[model samples]
Target: MLSRCSMLPSSSDVQSLQGLSGIRHLAESRRFKAWFLDQFGVLHDGKQPYPGAISTLEKLASNGAKMVIISNSSRRASTTMEKMKHLGFDPSLFVGTITSGELTYQYLKRRDDAWFAALGTSCIHMTWSDRGAISLEGLGLKVVENVVEAEFILAHGTEALGQASGSVRPMKLEDLEQILEQCAAKRIPMVVANPDFVTVEARALRIMPGTLASQYEKLGGEVKWMGKPGKIIYEAAMKMADADASDSIAVGDSLHHDIKGANAVGIQSAFITCGIHASELGLDSFAEVADISRVVALASKYSSCPSYVLPAFTW
Candidate 1:
């Protein structure tokens, strides 16, 4: 366990890379009035809850902490709630959730902005039907089979290629190169709802839509990002939480997504070292503490900083 600090920072506005033992320490400090949490790495690793994660959340809720889930998940908020409930987390504990998929669906349905209004309805949808697909049925968007017939690309999920022989079909990054080349040639714009390059999936990492969106950009295709590190999503989460920027803290594992987003929003951030960047931090287990210098170096490499660092999310 990390040595408990004698005292946590008195203000959430202070940006310090302090080491923290658990969520209980932060809760006791009462520095942050509300919490904006990331769903994947900070909460569960897809299949099961991280050690002490459920209890930590329960304790925070019982203490009346206003918490909101701000996720880069391509699944809608309701779908997220279903998974949370299945994992034995009480969804009511959170003020609400803001997911990239929910934002994408809203944008497509409302077409409230100039960029969305200019986009045509025909799109080649890359998705994961293996683990609950994100349906675009009500968006009034037509789903075309390929780039030739599509006007745009809505990337919700690209890792699963649908089931084959009763097994979940796996897709390679190279597999999408051909399709990406086609879209680039036709100048079809792509909307990446989730801007996380990869997500933790049961002790392993799975490629997310963000990686493909980045690749499409390299291929000269126009890409629109919608998730973490984006100011809008952060604002949406804060809106749901009714949190003041100075009184909130964002807890997440990804430096680029969570830390960078918090930096953009001018809030406190807690970095979980045991998540996606575990190997880079030289951690072999969740309980293994990360070298503070290396943790700082990693934060610099990602161009973001955390106000507090923890080996794992616990209480």
Candidate 2:
């Protein structure tokens, strides 16, 4: 494992990171021990690499610091890894990766013995169609078409579910409730993979798995959240990094999820301003307190604030 308590840049040194040109120097000089890279905007956008990402990653990797990507991506880890390689990102640069899909699979695998015994094999998996048709038979569980035919249900992402609701499309709460009612009548439990209510894509807001899960819980149905800011995902990332509470850092763009999750585990965090909330950058709120003021307020209300803020991952 890499050394966690190794000397970090003091406040004066931190000021240097505010500039992109200086980052190369600091990284080359061993200012940071390891980087907790955010996969989305920092490396590749959902479909492709952002400009300068490859060079930045290559430079950092050549500088000798350990790099690990921690993402909320719902795709399987293998898919993400393959995409990275396709984009010409040196796979060796990343010491480890923790994706929501991979983590969810592990969680199911470990609890299989107990879950299988209690729930039986018959199950209906209700989630977004993008989650793919996963068969639990390989996991020793049976797959059923609808809730009525199943004893249990595994609910993953909700994109496909949202789109299929009505002609207006993008499943709304009212439409999802109808499906939940069907499962509820049969007393089926669902395992929620991604637990975000909504995610900002570029500038527009879109529903996520958490949005449906929240509604399900309100209707007395059971759900499980996977990935960041969640304790399980945080714990798994730490274990992979071989890092302790005080020795690690979490860098992400989401204030509610990334920042809050880091605080829950007592780890330091750096908020990247470009991804979900790009408009907040270069504002007084950001300049006055580094992190978003709302996040600063939340941190103060619940716990300590982030260690620093950058305009973007590169900066």
Q: After aligning candidate 2 to the native by TM-score, how far in Å is the CA of 97 from where it should be?
A: 1.7
Tell me each candidate's RMSD, in Å, in order: 5.3, 6.0
Model 1 has an lDDT value of 0.80
Model 1 residue runs over 4 Å out of place are: 1-20, 160-171
Candidate 1: tens digits of C-alpha lDDT, residues 1-315:
111221222234233333434687788885577899997888899998888888888888887789998999998899898899999898889898899989988998999899999999888777775665666767877776656788988888875432212233446667766778888999999998889999999989988899999899999999989989898898898788887787788999999999888888787788888899999989888756887778777777887768888877787
The superposed Cα distance between candidate 1 and the true structure at residue 140, in angstroms, equals 0.9
The local lDDT score (0 to 100) that residue 289 gets in candidate 1 is 81
By summed lDDT, the worst window of 10 consecutive residues in model 2 runs over 160-169
Tens digits of per-residue lDDT, candidate 2, 1-315, equal 321212332233223234444346446553465667767645655556656677877876776656677777665677778878897787887878877767766766666546534655565554555435433323655555556667765555564342212212235446666877888776677766666565555344456666667777887887666777687777777777676665566777676667667766766666655555554443332222243454445444433345655655552
lDDT of 2: 0.60
Worst 10 residues of 1 by lDDT: 1-10
